[model samples]
Target: MINDSGTLAQSHLLIVDDSLDELRILKSLLDAHHFRLSVAFDGLQGYQRAQTLRPDLILMDVRMPKADGFSACRLLKANPQTRDIPVVFLSAAASPEERLTGLSIGGVDYVTKPFLAEEVLARVRIHLQLASRHMDTQEGAAEALDPDEVLLQAGIALIRSRLGETLTVDEIATRVGSYGKKLSAVFRERTGLTVFAFLREERLKTGRRWLADTDTSIQDVADQLCFQNAGNFATAFRERFGLTPTAYRKSVRAGRLIEA
Candidate 1:
């Protein structure tokens, strides 16, 4: 997801705020400095854009509707793909407590509102330089994870957490902050399986584990895995593992183990 409009040397920054006037002022100022800028009008949009754009830095307002700067920064830091991007808080409040809160939540810097053009530019430059230097030092020793792989891991995590619930690939993708098409493409490219195919495999695997390790009934297992019914689950289980759920559980209890 490279910024196509900017050259490799240009720094890309995302500005997140509700104020159109503020966006205009910041865009004008940053544009003059030859920075590639993207804008989001609220915290939610800011988080989504940050995930997709992977900007080098973010300038976010503190008291935005939907999500504030602190909440957005927390989400960014929590995400493996977007965690490394630096965030700078832009706020009208100059209180020490507010600044402390911002810094504690992974903001790299804080710039007060009614920005002084020179100061803002200077801070942006310093943070960008620091990030570049850090990347340089880590280049050969540790490679950064591929962005697609990161997205795939995030999607897998969401899927595993919600296996008991009925979910489509599109819902999983959206929950992971990506589109269905892109997630499907990445899953196919990386795993040689569609997203739904992978989910189905995982469901069957879990069912096998439950059969062996738990005393749960076949009907309950099928229902929990979102299968249509015990009959459907039994068919799928037999197809996958050459044993029906009832037979599998009985075999396990009888000390005749089958490979999971």
Candidate 2:
């Protein structure tokens, strides 16, 4: 049974959205979790309600009429009265850029739309618990991520944005404001691969996709991936796929190598 005798039941949640159907769906989900909720149809209304009620948490939609979630979050964060209230963005935009933007502008977390109900409940419970901890110990730090995690996240953002270009661990570390060794250690610890190894894997994965889909020449594909030269790329490719780039494409076109 959903408890009415816990922290979750008493915590007030404000959900800002434009879709009535989504509002109903979320309300039903949170109701089962026994969370008290207030609704807003747009960012402007959400901000107004936030100011008035100062709910324990805010669930924001990115795109809305009258105002957007980003703008409302900015306004809320600027005001001393509502600044500390945790706002989690529930948006359909799944790109890394979108998620980063929300985080940059004071969103505690960003959950993409079409989310699992269980995941939503889990995230809400965790954030609310964190908020409770902050109240107990008035640390009052601004955003959830500490410096090291921020650097790691920024490094990943850089990697995704610059996939086709050659990158060094030192360069990524410098960009994220850390040294190469520290970045390397963190990267290895989190991913079980050295930074260079991870980059090579990403490049090879892209090369595999292009070879399978496009009729581009092997040398041209190598050039597109910013490989040192076609020969080096071909050697790496063969080692990875058990076939030369030329052979892989030919076998794929001839239906000899079944695609998984």
Candidate 3:
């Protein structure tokens, strides 16, 4: 979908987050874009306004005091009245796994924190235009897939939510009441990955974040991501990003930018 010059004048946006600093940063950028704005500091209040106002777009924070962004998104997607509204997640949780989780649960876009203003504006404008077209489609015409696809998505979501634990595909299959081998096949078909491969990638992504964004010890980062030991974690981290965890952290702290 495309928009002309006056497209943004009629739009409304809802932003939900617990951090005043983050909200202010977004508001400063978005206010210049000239859309109507409403703010909520927690997920519950955010959801209430979503239901009442039915805004053109929503910008949600992943971590909040009340119901988190994922849960709130599920509610919006499941509701008939609000199901077509677009949601964009704003968070520091930047990783392939986190992005997948947000999209699977119905976010239209994901914006990583400390984000560039131009990128945020571009994404918000694109999703808003996309949602405008989506709402114009006839009811019940969105893509339809098997319930099994949903199950695989849910299993992955569980994995992302429990990154701190020693999770196995077998345990997840049991929890979701599916056989291990069948679930693995479903995962491969849907995501081009076996469950273990995806799990390892997600763990590495988490380890990288902790190294740069927190003052976590190498051993502690390994423990948090459920790596077997610090040695193994260092080996895997270096292989993935071509730097030891400590070097990566130091480079980031020194303002020499590197993508995680």
The candidate that wins on lDDT is: 1
Expressed as tens digits, the lDDT of each residue in 1-260 for candidate 1 is: 12344233678999999999999999999999788889999887998899888888899898887667776776676576677788999889679988987887678999998889899988888887777666656533323466577678767766675689889877776655567899999999998999998898889999999989988899999999999999999999999999898888889899999884
C-alpha RMSD between model 3 and the true structure: 13.3
- Error of model 1, residue 133, in angstroms: 24
- lDDT, candidate 2, 1-260, per-residue tens: 11345455567899999999999999999887777889999887887798788898999988886667876776576555677789999989778988997898679999999999888888988888777766667665455444345445556665665677778898766544457998898788878888888778777778888898998887888887889889999999888878888888888889887443
TM-score quality measure for candidate 2: 0.51
List residue ranges in candidate 1 displaced over 4 A. Answer: 1-143
Report the C-alpha displacement of residue 255, candidate 2, in angstroms: 72
By the TM-score metric, which is better: model 2 or model 3? 3
TM-scores, each model vs. reference: 0.53, 0.51, 0.53
lDDT (C-alpha) at residue 21 in model 2: 90
Give the root-mean-square deviation of each candidate in angstroms: 9.9, 13.3, 13.3
Q: Which pairs of residues collide in model 2?
A: none
Name every residue pair that clashes in candidate 3: none
Q: Which stretches of candidate 3 lie over 4 Å from their true place?
A: 1-6, 139-260
Provide the overall lDDT of each model, using Cα atoms, as 2-decimal numbers.
0.82, 0.79, 0.80
